[model samples]
Target: MRHAETVTFGGSALNRAAELRGDKADVLALNENSRSIALWRGKPLICGTNLDQLALLPVSQDLFSEADEPPVPPIFLGQSEDGSALFAHDISAWEPAALDTAAMQQFVDPTQQHHPALPDDHRFVELRGVMAQLSARDAELAATARSIFGWHRSHRFCSNCGAESRMAMSGWQRNCPTCKTSHFPRTDPVVIMLITRGNKVLMGRSPGWPDGMYSLLAGFVEPGETLEAAVRREVYEEAGIRVGAVSYLSSQPWPFPSSLMFGCAGEALNEDITVDPHEIEDALWISREDMLTVFSGQHPTMKPSRKGAIAHFLLRNWLADRLD
Candidate 1:
């Protein structure tokens, strides 16, 4: 795991200026040097001939001040390399006339939305489709925005008292007036294990995943459960394979809806997969030789894991014998 942080969405050491979160006067002073990234219904505004650059507009960009102020206020994402303030705004209020809701819910949204006021090349695209191509900084900013915005959207009503809460601490926290309670954004922990026995690794596909799409078996870490226990329990529960000697690998901030994925390595005691039909549609062990074929697009039935995901990162390292 020497190069653990090298994983996409893992390496950028962005200077998150948490000290300024509660400083109203200093936060106001940021207007002079702040830049904002935008998200429309979770898709970030990106513009590049190759579609690799994230759109970091001036905080006062005219489009942001349109008739409808962004329902979710701008979130302070911390500072950039040059010490300039960085923030993210969710302009989910903008309604696209030809939105493909179905496509949005699929494995990866292929459709891009363009705002009438913005240039045609400047479009909001799904992060999953372009994550591997983005620079480390862009990937971090985009992930941070999508996760916090999704939190605010779903947690508008206070969980403690059922009262509407207000955004606070530069969108890092929510305050409930009636209950006088403060809540912070929560990232659910998920354990995605690289379970292996001999030269083969365990791979599984969910019920509705696209044909031939498979990834390492994963499950949420239950409360009071350690990462090691979660790895063992999940593999057994989903694929009916007992695992032992779990070890940590790299991790990724997966923002499909806000999840911190713990990529771990595990030794499988048995490969007799009695797949829990409710947990996964199928699970099987693929040898190192066959996996390489999948990675090179030569396998006719099993597609490689998505490029930007932690599963792919772990598998790539494992194949290269770098999982030391």
Candidate 2:
């Protein structure tokens, strides 16, 4: 699609300085100077405070948590405008209670502690707006953080030798102590596409989505399969539609447990959709005019895709005549 990169998370151009991950002192120095920051709920948590703030937390992991601790070595996320190095924190190593939603919300909202406002100079307020408006750069960083940390959590034992692996390369890799095997993080690729024969676009609903919520057909790219092949297979498998001449449109790093979404536009060779009961609950093709109504919140039964996701991005651009 022409406006593919104009998609929400696709637009923000955050510079991720990947070359500095191996230099411990340099990475630490950058974190020591960064200003704009936010925290993530899973991996890649934005530590709004400095090193001292981490020390001040009442429940440090070494004292209270049973999980294996992450190496103190930090990963370089990138840099702020003033040249301060952005760093990611694996709060995964911290005690659960210290990073729980309730506790973090209190930090974000200091009024919960009954503290008086200090002329609005609070750091939380300073960073709140930017954090709330999710950026493409932040989305990429968060996905990287979640995927790497999740790899660390699940791959602690070496698959080859059954030995415990230690974190290396500032959390980018795991080295098995006994077998000398190295493990790297993984991103599973998924294909999400809008199949259009003419004015109508196909959409489907999975078993657990919110009532009335439907989205473009999507499925994971299997081993050794091309992206176009995956799109065709997935559409056939889920809705019994024969897809042809699939074309790449855009992509998004969806961090709902680590997925890279490949957005595409495909041609449906057949119009009849035979819904696969096991994979989808219902399937239908909504016309362009009705899709506009759906986008405008006037559809009687269907709701548009969630805002931050690629499906919404694809559909919106398609409607705007920017995806052709």
The models' CA-based lDDT, in order, is: 0.90, 0.65
Q: What is the C-alpha RMSD of each candidate to the true structure, in Å?
A: 1.4, 6.6
> Which candidate leads the pack in TM-score?
1
Q: Estimate, for each residue in 1-324, the C-alpha lDDT of model 2 and write its tens digit.
A: 667776544565666655666665354544434432222234232222331121111222232223335334444556555666655544334333232355455423322111121111222221222323445566555555555656666788999999898877666778898989998777789999899989889999998666789999999999999999999999999999999898999987765556789998999999999999999999999999999999888999998777767788888888887887
Q: Which stretches of candidate 1 lie over 4 Å from their true place?
A: 25-30, 67-71
Q: What is the TM-score of each candidate against the true structure?
A: 0.97, 0.77
Cα displacement (Å) at residue 58, model 2: 18
Flag regions of model 2 displaced more than 4 Å. 24-27, 34-73, 93-132
Q: What is candidate 1's lDDT per residue for 1-324, written digit by digit as tens?
A: 898998888789998888878566246535767898999889999999888989988888767767255445678888877878888888888777887888787778898999988877899999999999999999999999999999999999999999999998888999999999999999999999999999999999998899999999999999999999999999999999999899999899999899999999999999798989989999999999999999999999999999999999999999999998
Residue 283 of model 1, lDDT score: 93
